[model samples]
Target: MTQTLVKAPFRADQVGSLLRPESLKKAKNEYKAGKITAEQLHEVERQEIKRAVDKQIEAGLQVVTEGEFGRDWWHSTFMEHLLGAEGYIPEQGYNFSNQETDPYDVRLVDKVAYNPNHPFFQQAKELVEIVGDRAVVKFTIPSPNQFFHPNIINGQYKDFEEFAPDIIQAYKETIHEFYRIGIRYLQLDDVYLAVIATADFPPEEKKYLAELAVRVVNGVLEGKPEDLTVTTHVCRGNYRSDYSFSGGYDTVAPIVFANEKVDGFFLEYDDERSGSFEPLKYIPKGGPRVVLGLVTSKTGQLEDKEAIKARVQEATKYVPLEQLCLSPQCGFASTHHGNILTEEEQWEKLRFVVETANEIWE
Candidate 1:
């Protein structure tokens, strides 16, 4: 069989389609309304997390994540939770492509400061203990590059170039911290890497950013144990019923695919927005494997089984079938408010992935 989802479950308050029963929602509403303390919200999350973990294992997934349960948003949740991060509410253009975006520039409060007290760092160390065996515990962190990616400095950057030094340092430390905590399957969520690779940026500029991303991420892996399984997920975007950046992997191509310092590449190929499978050839013929996100997490609709099989077959033309795997194009949800899909609908979609894999590989 091909590769399986290294981590398949979601966490409580995770950025996916899993639900927290109405009771917890009602409690959260009360908490937000000033009737309860933060402790109440924490209490609910703790209880709900256990239930989410149980449900994931029951579904037969072997690699389970906390579903980013404690995180608020997917990309920058870890940033805000960091010690020195503060919001830089901007008075400017939108950060994403969708118009429904709420305008408020929430930039990192600090330019640089690595406080050693990140909750996810500590939480991940304990996550495996709570995950309850039979599945490899997995965790997703923003790519080191994104941590220091200079954004619109008044609509551009003081210098996207200036971000390089700090990006390297910050990511190096962040990665080691996870390794120290005993993390094994670490998935670096890298949207920006693919974005710059495909954008109209100058060739030198794109190469610089790609090289820097690899430098920082790989630098973090410099002295790691061989057992570490590092994977990267190149998502277009997943927000509150919104999509972020969009472009085919064709833009990034073999550069981002071959450059990332990882064991696998989770490429989003759910729809036309993801482009064709020809780019799969850019992936080094015998390097890391590719997890084809043939199943999509954007909606509840399951993929046609025969069609997905055919697509997978087509992909083997570029990369060997044995080197391929399956998964939802992106996280079912990448924010506290997940995409508009029922929980049952989400399960059916995942069931399709598992069933499809069973037929194709087993």
Candidate 2:
């Protein structure tokens, strides 16, 4: 049997809106309705974030985040006040077809006028300072490409090709900005890349998009300190308790593999909807660590360890087994409503990931 490595289990994002407890939201509403100032809103978030960081450490996790404590969901919802993205309100998102929640609307903001001091980055800086040296402080940001992607709010693009350069510049600026802030781990949350990549596109078109994505992503990452570790998390789509785009690595493979800058990849492989492991061949062996999102945070059920091990083996045929890691497919909650699973069930799933990883890799 191939030897496996047991690394600590980590979450892409902890359901922040859920973690803060019901009292916090009530405070937020009271403040919004003429009871509190922005400072109060932030104070509550700060208190909860501290609690969140402590709990993560207790979870037997080494790479802990503030559970994205200040963020409502993913990196998008946090953009409401700054970017003017409509995510602050509850609306029907592109994913979760029939479901609705107090969600933000699609974003149309461009990279040209983007501001770095937005609340998202501002509070993130504070969180890093507070969590100092406790755990790897990670900031998850939306890829610039989301602005031009079809279906998002203000995504006026009829053709994505022309939008490439500005997108690159925007993302490049973002990475540099984050690095300057003393942040080391930047998790680029990309959802559209998984959905739009399809077999129908001509090879040239596919290659062009791939090149653009890799180029812009890497461009933003250029000149970073060697000590930094960049991770990219590819999501099919996680919205108000719903799925968005669905496909496999076959379409984006090798294209995804083409980029070698990111130190780790938190990829979705929780179900067959992600496609077979065959496309994994494209990833350059031993390039970056691969965090196989085998344990799902979407539902209450636990995955079988035996099956997970087999999948890891199958994947090893492409990338080195030593280069692999484990995690949940995506955030337990990309939105405030969170998934259908209870907190206990979520922990059990995470327990399964760590335990299964230990048994296989050790």
> Over the stretch 1-362, how does candidate 2's per-residue lDDT look in tens digits?
22132222232222122333455667777777988887887788778778767766555555556565566666565444433344434344343545544535555544333457666667678878878887767777766555544544355444555555555665566567667777776777777577557436787877777777777677667777777777778777765456766678776777776574777777888887787777777777767777888877778888787888898888888788777777788877665556777767766765566667666666
Task: State the C-alpha lDDT per candidate.
Answer: 0.68, 0.65
Cα lDDT tens digits for candidate 1, 116-225: 78778866876777775666777888776665455522222356556545545666677678878877778878877767755889888777777667766776667666
- lDDT for 229 (candidate 2): 72
Superposed by TM-score, candidate 1 places the C-alpha of residue 27 at a distance from the truth, in angstroms, of: 4.0
- Residue 296, model 1, lDDT: 72
TM match of model 2 to true structure: 0.84
Off by over 4 Å in 2: 1-20, 78-92, 97-103, 106-111, 150-163, 198-204
In candidate 1, position 192 carries an lDDT of 74
